[model samples]
Target: MRLSNKRKAPLYNFINTALIMFLVMGILAFFAEEMRFQLLGMEAYLFIAVPAMLIIIFYLNGRQIFEYDSDGEALHFRNRNIVPFMSTPLSDEFPKYKFVKFETFTFLFFKRLYITINSKSGNTILKYEISYLTWKELNDLKFSLNKVIKNNKEKVNDE
Candidate 1:
């Protein structure tokens, strides 16, 4: 099975632009108010708080394109940010039997997948951003990963 979220990456540009536009509008509106001191309620709060909160939340999301391929004899994983400069890309390929385990976790809006793989030196864990995947895609990924783990167990038994 193969899973990819590359198609959805283009939407980030629109989202980023919209967020910036909202922040700019908020700042402009706040300054445009003639009586800055008179503002002392939700109206004043919304102008600054909302935009700042948006930026902070967006930064925490770390929206990265994720690709996973389990074809032939190896499993492939690729993770890269659509923003380019945010982080270095992670590309890995290893044998099916070497896949030790896989886990997932979410913090606030941040979601990630951690894959543990076996090696001669030690077991290494890989992290992938899964914040942008749809429900179907996430399920497919879980299924694929479980299948690999099952296969790995079988191979161990045979050995």
Candidate 2:
């Protein structure tokens, strides 16, 4: 089973908007100051660095995809961009993984989730931050994770 979850969060939107505004402001500041490298020594560096960093951040935030692949016995986390990558398996031994949900109180209520994988080596915890997931996606992820966990638990018991 392959479950595709799209996580959209206002926090990312906010950050993207803020970054864009900063880029614009930085550009204007660069030009308005007449490229005075001596007077604006540190600020001059912002022009080149901010755009480069923003491009990377945009690619990472915009093109992310997470997949739960049961048949392959793996959870794949990917970022669809120039750099394509997959998550490393927990370990050679089949590790036990479970999903946990918790709520955060901000201006509004937000629900968060994380995956805990237990292996012979150690335990690995992957937290799904509010910036990466919305409440709806979190619920869907929880449901899918619960199903996977139940099946694994049953298989363990049967063996």
Candidate 3:
């Protein structure tokens, strides 16, 4: 099964980013004035430069587009611009058990699924922001991931 990117709540990312940026800007405004008043000139610039750089980076690369090909056991994520240099693929062996976890709030407005792959080398986690997925797609992803993980584990055990 192939799961293409779903676009829902397009402004969700923008809202989150704006909220965090606003908080940082507010802090800088409050603190910078206080520091200048107190004769701490250099410290004021540090506070502005550091977080401003971080916010710029976050706005540029924080949101990604995810593409999943379950039949091929490949998952790919890339920056919004779809640049090949920014693409990341998470494809390989599956974890032993409980490789997927579903998280939802009580109100159920937000949902996320995390798929964790563990190997001899390290662990990688792929997150599915289900708020952007259809109900059928979300269920299929959970089922397909579990099925693949179970099959991989059994094959390893047999050997």
TM-score of each model, in listed order: 0.85, 0.45, 0.44
TM-score of 1: 0.85
User: Residue 120 CA error for candidate 3 (Å)?
Assistant: 4.9
**Candidate no. 3 TM-score:** 0.44
Tens-digit lDDT track of model 1 for 1-159: 888888877687777778888999987777766356555455765887798898778767765688999989999999887777877888999988889898989776688999999888899998888887877898899999998889878877999
Quote the positional error of residue 106 for candidate 1 in Å.
3.0
TM-score leaderboard ranking: 1, 2, 3
Which candidate leads in lDDT?
A: 1
Clashes per model (N, Cα, C within 3 A): 0, 0, 0
Q: What clash pairs does model 1 have?
A: none
Predicted candidate 1: what Cα RMSD to the true structure? 2.4
What are the Cα lDDT values of the candidates?
0.83, 0.51, 0.53
lDDT of 2 by residue, 35-147 (tens): 55457766776886777688565644433334444445555433232123423322122333432222333233333334566645666665433324456655675666677
Estimate the Cα RMSD of every predicted model relative to the unseen true structure: 2.4, 7.5, 8.5
Task: Give the candidate order by descending lDDT.
Answer: 1, 3, 2
State residue 15's C-alpha deviation in candidate 2, in Å: 8.6
> Residue pairs in steric clash, candidate 2?
none
Summing lDDT over every window of 10 consecutive residues in candidate 2, give the lowest-scoring window.
86-95
